[model samples]
Target: MTNRTFDEMQPGDRAELRRLITADDLFVFAAASGNSNPMHLTDTDVDGNGTAERIAPGMFMASLISAVLGTQLPGPGTLYRRQTLDFHTRAHAGEEVIVRAEVVSKAEGMVRLRTEVTHADGRQILTGEAEVIAPVEKFDREDVEVPGLVVQRHRHFEALLERARPLPALPTAVVCPNEAKSLGGALLAARESVISPILIGEAEAIRRAADEIGADLGGIEVIDVAGDAAAAELACRLVHDHRAAAVMKGHLHTDDLLKPMLDKAHGLRVGRRFTHVFVMDVPGHPEPLFVTDAAINIAPDLATKMDICQNAIDLALSLGMEPRVGVLSAVETVNPAIQSSIDAALLSKMADRGQIKGGQVEGPLAMDNAVDMGAARTKGLKGSVAGRANILVVPGLDAGNMLAKQLAFISHAEGAGLVLGAKVPVILNSRSDSPMSRLASCAVAAIRHFAGAR
Candidate 1:
């Protein structure tokens, strides 16, 4: 006839038990809850993956506590009627996690209780009210924030790279011979952060290149393909077989590497048009400026252009850019002879009608008009994407490649290029591309990968 104590009648409180989450605990919870959001586990919640170190997924903690409430505490016979949860701050990992329920009132077969799950710092991470029909049942509660890094730091890309932590040691394959230097860059990237490398060229050549580059190839594994062609084929196979998560284009011809990748039967081709992107760092631009179709697709039609736009949008999202795209051309009007101008108009409208996702697009703007508002005004054009464009979709390979090179050579801009829309961010740098540029591309890909970018 006496009312039972909250703990006595229900599951033992984690608060009362006073337990701390270990590395194992974090890993288990992450796997079990599908809350692989790094911010909940890592130190920086800054990148697209860890944007704000968000308060852990409420569903994660609620489910964890509910397991105890249903299976162990109240055990076997409980009916969960209703409950409301309010989340405030973050209950980061490693700290002791607490769950407590205070019985408030019970009448007419209804039980009302105030519940709280607080961090060890005594700050309440989750607090709310719960109600049940006396024969209490298990209940779960779940938020607005996107899980990956979607916001950029108020600083520079170099600074952002400085802030990045080591990658998860995911397998990486480096194309042979000359690309061994790329493997060296990967090594530098790994020496500092994520992207574990598996060199797939001739062992002797890979080591020799690694040694000349002064990279730590001691622990590096050599797959020993006969030549660049074989190495590229092997690299693609590794990715297809799941041996590597990312494929890096090392000292091999882009055409040779892509031949195997695009093979319908035995490669990593996902049946989409293969496109290229160059991540450029300009002194005046706030974030890394990424341009696309620079290295592939001589003159993409509407279909291929769509893929290029989408891929750039994903990369921009990873870079925390709002993805304002400008289809670069000589003029804003869709002149009959100017196919680029027409394509730009179509792409922009496609974006407006929801054909494109996660960004805005406009086209046929002159280079000066696309980048400089004053230039746009002088040309008597007006629109958001007409000026201040972040992702430039050039009309053809000629225009796109030429425009990108001007930004690099003539203006001396800093840029890195990658091929996207693949399973992962593909690192494809030309020999003309400086070592620093190659490293920059790798850093951008790492940031994008950690951010869970496509």
Candidate 2:
């Protein structure tokens, strides 16, 4: 960057910058300015005209002129004396604007500049004039670095919901929805058109739960079952009778919910054993992260681990993501002393030898090199699944459960749990899951059902 000295400046000398205003920019500006007006912060119809507007604050537009004055024209060591601004129109997120500044006049150690901000389509948004103490010394330097900002929002799950909204709502048998949290979650998914839930539990308890949440259960099917195990068994019967496309665990222990589905005579199993996968929407991650066998398959053997990998890979494919499986261990290299590292090596070789299909599998990767590019590079790892793994296959239930919880509590990720390898996807949400998590679980199940049908 080079700056024009006070003596070098002249009338009509101009500088301009084009900036694309983004939603993140608006949020950052709101945080920096401490202005939380709904008109500028929210993307909603403030005036009730119909168009949702995330209007950029007027001062945000004015700051563009400041950026131009400080970096360009009389670029460095510039001090603001006085400024006047006139708002002509509104700027919005996702719009580009041009901020231009022109030297109007010069005085003793001071310069006057005309500034204006206009939309990319030529509509003026803001016009202003500024007087500044221009730099007397000719200043030149490289660009300065600034820290980056990460907006902690769950965009991946939101996108998954959007993708699922177009599909036909999956017919889900919600087992034992006898409490407010579970019943409310199913109803919320129903409202979002992600699921058509058949409430299978005690009729009085179901209605009581509905009343507790102020929900109307009209036009929804409710099956009155007396016991948790009986309700789960009835849900399995519904799947066999072609009444439900999926089963949702609601307000019951996971063992009771899944035990009926494992019956050899009337089970929902197609072939492989059921394995749990947590589809985590971590903030700032480019895609969904899959953590598998978290809720089931405690200390799985090599065969069960293979099933876990295949189940997660299939789910990833159903969600339209090319699966890159990273079988995680304590170290990146196979060691005779470490059983997990040995298992990871075997999993990688098995995938290479066509034992596991539809995904790229690489393993014996520690947590760092599995998901982080810089860490992988530093460790001299080069492969598709080494650094950019979307699916993390852990050694046992303990590691998988801990990893998923760490991402949820520490990293602030939203997780949608699903049990795969059955005839239908099982929505395995917990009592502590937020509404969005439950809804996302339904969306994922619906998406997977439709995708598999195709």
Candidate 3:
């Protein structure tokens, strides 16, 4: 960085900078300025046009002028005296704009400059003038670095919903949707056209739940079943009869829901045991993160862990992701005393032998090395899945559950839970899940269902 002194300033001296507007920039600006008007937000449609314009805030364009004054032209140690702005047109996220400042005059230890911002196509967006006190002494220094910001947005889930929207809604048997949270979540997915829900629960309780959420249950199927177990059984029957393509847990214990599905005589079970996967959209992560056996499979043995890995890999492939499985353990190296490390090493070898298909599998990775390049490099680990693993296969249920929850609560990730390896996808959602989380679960199930159909 270099600055011009007041005495050295001359007419026609100019400086300019170009910036490409991004959706995150709008969010960051909104957060920093406390101006959350929908017009300046990335996900809002103020005109009822159904498309988000993501218009850049006018003040944001004006701020570019300040950037020029502080860093360029009168480069450093510049103090603002007065400024005037005139808006000509609009700028939006994803557009590039050039901000320019030119020296106009100097008097009374103050420098006046003509400032303007224009689109890359030569269309003017903002015209402005700035008056500032130029630095008395020449200033020169290295550029200062500032920390980057990541907006806590669940874009992965959003993309999943978008991909599922084009498919025919999956006919889902929602077992025991007798509470506001559960019923409302199913209905929300219905509204989004992700699922066509067949409500299987007590009619009166379902109606009450609809009332609580102010949701209309008109034209939607409602099967009256007295007990939770009965409703779950009926849902399983629906899947067996091919009336429903997916099973959704609603306001019922997971054990009750899966017990009927596990029946040998009449069940939704395939050969593989049921395994749970949480598809998480963590903020700032470049890709979706998958945690397996989080809600099921306690203390899984070698065979069960193989099923877990294969199920997760299948789910990832269904979602168009190339699975990179990281069997997490206490340490990156195998220790004979550490059962998890041994299991991880065995899983890696099994994957190499084509036992666990459709993924790059590596194991005995601590949590840090599994997802972080720096940690993986520090440990001198070299494998396709060592550092870039998207699917984290924990040693047991306890570890998987804790890791998923930590990402959800502490890392501010939104998760969509699903039970895989069944004949059909099972949408599993928690009572404490947000509406988006619930909807995302249904969306994931719908996508997986359609992908299998194809």
Candidate 4:
């Protein structure tokens, strides 16, 4: 790897560092970097009004600076002297931000410069000045091949879905088996794992649907339920009675399923808030990104958020991440007006003080500053998880849902959902989700089950 010092930087040079702020990116940054600000993106309007608005992390601005300073300005092998910055406002994805730098002075082996990354709206996100030392002459280079990155998932949907195979051997239960698509998804999941299928619903309808979908039902046990209400009850009973290790939802309303699953007596409570998280894989990002509460927990408070954070951290640890969390918000600084920013700071300090463990927490950061080290450097932010974040804790469900859908639909990202903070893994996916996403969700759920059971 080529290390960069700040010497090769020049005046009047400008470049754009390509960063696609997909939902996965936003989710990861929010957890790993701690910048769950309101301005990143909107998930849902509380009144069902319209949309959600979120601010990009100022640390993202700092990350852009590092990108320019190291990759563009100094052209590598440049020495970093010092840098300072201030954020004037917020920025978000779908908006373009440009980083510009000018060489102010050239002295004995030293160059002084000022730089800023701003939104197209002309608002300055971050402004800073720096001193760098670089070689006057350039190093010789030979045109040679560089190794490519090894990928675990990509455009191949089937391969990505089957990455983790031979799922669970325990019998699994499907709740509210009214919707054919939901039953189909569950059936597909069954084929991938050793988990025997126990269909809890209208026996006649379930069988007819299975025939239409061409799914086998020979070994599947079809439990007849009188109606949606009875079906919902039976699904939870299966889990509570130790008939199944996992529960899958079919066609009933989310409330219908949640009611029985969370009945306190028959509920699958793990002594913490139950939440939904979608593991995302964007094209540019190398690994899976987890976006949470997208389908559950509308507006989580700080304590619930702590549970959410722990849940995401637990999934990352399961997926082999040492676990770094970024609490997201509109700005990287604590603002009295915004509870999210204040909470982000408290959580960061909490992580430091051992109140929250299993990861490095930083925030009050925007989205960009969370993932891009270049943005971190330009803004002169030094923290544990500023540039390299492993988990993202979103402020609310609106942010989480919109972020996940945007990446899954608008941008090219894989959405693999799993419900964490439970005694066992839960694959609760949406009908709008792709089959591969459904399969990947099952994979994550099954792997968690297998690993936890051991």
Candidate 5:
């Protein structure tokens, strides 16, 4: 550790830190700063778009200057007063850059420094001047490691918007929004242009709840139904009549809304069995995991599991992923007593025999083997979907629900729930879910609704 005091510092003293740029560095910077510009994110150079090559934000590179000043130059007890910077060129990814700061002048309490950043080739990128109040006393402290921050930039929301940009917002009927979370989510989605919500519930109660949540219901369509059952029926009726493109589960129980969708006469069922999928963006997972049957299909048999697997695969394809299915079990071996392992083996065979299509399937795998290649190798498991499986098809609803909730609560994931295999996608959000989660569900449903139209 280096420490510099005002008494020890002389004019023209300099300190420099050198580092190579990395993609993770750029991503972390973007995440921390909430800069979602495509020019900084994408690899392919947009031709004639008047943007430079895949570049990191100028301020991101300049932050290294602040780091050098506070941590090394005036060293730790320096308070940054002001900074003036000029960026000459875009600092791109994969380029080495050096940050240099030199003490230019020192007043009684204020110290001014000249700062500049240059490429490995000595091309100037940024030059700045920083004035700081240096510590007079020996303000000594032991060096500590800064904890890594999990900057969830909400990249999931951006990706969803890319798919949703061209399509029109879905006319969605939100069933039985008796509380703030449900009603507020729908209103937020509508505000974001993701869903054109037709709020279906008791009008006076809905308005009161909306007031409590500070959501304006003016100019928004609201169907005044007497109770939860009637609201569910009307929501289903709207979808069946093509008046609404989707139905969303609100404050009521999932069964309350789902029952109307299962009706033979007026339900939104096509020829396929309805199931649920939770799209999860876990912290360290390289890709989003499509978790299936988490909210539906309790203890499904082989045939029903097949439908569940196919439904997940279809959703993955809609999102432009050639999904590798991992049929998870307690252990990576078929046993006579454990029915999950048996079903896993059967699903694998079904994929091989062309009974289940549109995904690469491998199964009879424990959680570790399904997700970790090293674990898979250690267990002598060799298959395409063994380690790199992005879609997790759990044994039953209990297992799937637990796994998805663990990823959401324990790992702090961004989750969106949707019902697949229906005539229209059902945006499903729990009463306790965040507004962002609900908005994400609406985006997924809108994308699925438009994709289904094709």
Candidate 6:
């Protein structure tokens, strides 16, 4: 690589680089830049030209000029001052893009370059002009290692929304909409046609919060209620009365929402006990992970864990997956001292007795043995669920909660939560969760709703 100084640069100085625009490239770009307009990346989205091909963003094409200037022409130490761009045509994914830059003039340590980007077919996609301050003196630079980019795919939530798209928007009662994340989630799901939101909370408070967030709630139904508890009661009532198919927690404590549902008289309780599952999409993991008892069951006993395991298995079935339950413990052997290992052994035996259905159950396995085949083989663990478990049944709520949070924050996994074993799926979300999290929960509820009806 050569670094050209202002003294060495001439009128004819030029540089060019070619790169293939791949699907992963487009996906990373869209996610990193937050430019998720479907027309730019979605193949099924209709563009203005009535084409379905994935078109790259105009700025994405123009970025090649900057790359050329920094890495090739005035290579390294080039300071970009200004640039003018014109998009001539849309660049689709898988097309090879060639970027060429020619120095039009150089004066007073500044170089003016004429840049153009064309497809492999020689069709011009973008033309631009850049003014950069050239290095006055060249320095012999050693190769610097650049950090790799970490792209959060959020594909688990995306797939959930896709599954919910075919079904009509389920009418969902959102309790306590005075907060932005919850309200924004409800509105976003409604916009995507995943849920028809029936807002039940303080009307003026909801409107005020909406105004602060610039949410347009026009024509949306709002049922006025005083507090979070009242909102929860009404939301559950709507579900019980067949006025709503699902209930969403909004700006309220988890206990507030669950209290009304556990009433046993007016609640939405089915035959089973209510438990929560965090559907996690972890990068580098082969499949989606079902982490149970994370949100709802705090310190459940053996009987409660049975419900947790069954609920997670039912959820896996709802998502069209073959459930493989791993009874996770600290060690892979039954120890009376470690209650978790004992519970794991019992859970596995219970599955054999038809106490748990529709899932392959394996027990007393460490977390590594459950998910990693190599580790399981090294530990002499052999079973369908031992090495390839999709649903991990933790012994207690604390371990499950920490595992799910670690996957989400440390491993950059996307998590969508649902409380099952009720007549209707209850979407449970954290205040820090994104709108996509809420949408994903709604999608889960929608799938559960429809699947149960069948």
Give lDDT for model 6. 0.87
Worst 10 residues of 2 by lDDT: 143-152
Greater-TM-score candidate between 4 and 6: 6
* Candidate 4 structure lDDT: 0.70
Query: What would the per-residue lDDT of candidate 4 be over residues 157-255, giving only the tens digit for each residue?
Result: 344444456444546677655556877777776777634568888888888888888877887788888787787677667777778777666777777
Clashing residue pairs in all predictions, respectively, total 18, 0, 0, 59, 0, 0
Mark the regions of model 3 whose C-alpha exceeds 4 Å error after superposition.
42-45, 48-52, 137-143
Tens digits of lDDT, candidate 1, 1-454 = 1223333443333223345654445555677668777765555655655354534556766654554444333333444677788888756555677777655666665556666777876888778766655543333323223354212121254664664555565467878644445666777766765567888877877777777877666776778778777887788778878887777888777898788877778877776788998888765455566678888899899989999999899878877778989888777889989888889889999999999899988887778888888888888888787668888888888877887888777656667778886776678887776666766777777777778834
Tens-digit lDDT string for candidate 3 (283-319)? 9999999999899899999899999999999999999
TM-score of 6: 0.74
Cα RMSD for candidates in order: 16.6, 2.6, 1.9, 17.6, 6.8, 6.7
Candidate with the larger TM-score of 2 and 5: 2
**TM-scores for candidates 1 onward, in order:** 0.64, 0.91, 0.95, 0.64, 0.77, 0.74
Ranking by lDDT: 2, 3, 6, 5, 1, 4
Candidate 6, residue 110: how far the Cα is off, in Å: 32
Please write out the lDDT profile of model 6 over residues 373-428, one tens digit for every residue. 89999998887887899999887788998999999889988788898888888988
User: What would the TM-score be for candidate 3 when compared with the true structure?
Assistant: 0.95
Q: Cα deviation of 326 in candidate 3 (Å)?
A: 1.4
**Which model, 1 or 3, shows the larger lDDT?**
3
Cα lDDT, all candidates: 0.71, 0.94, 0.93, 0.70, 0.86, 0.87
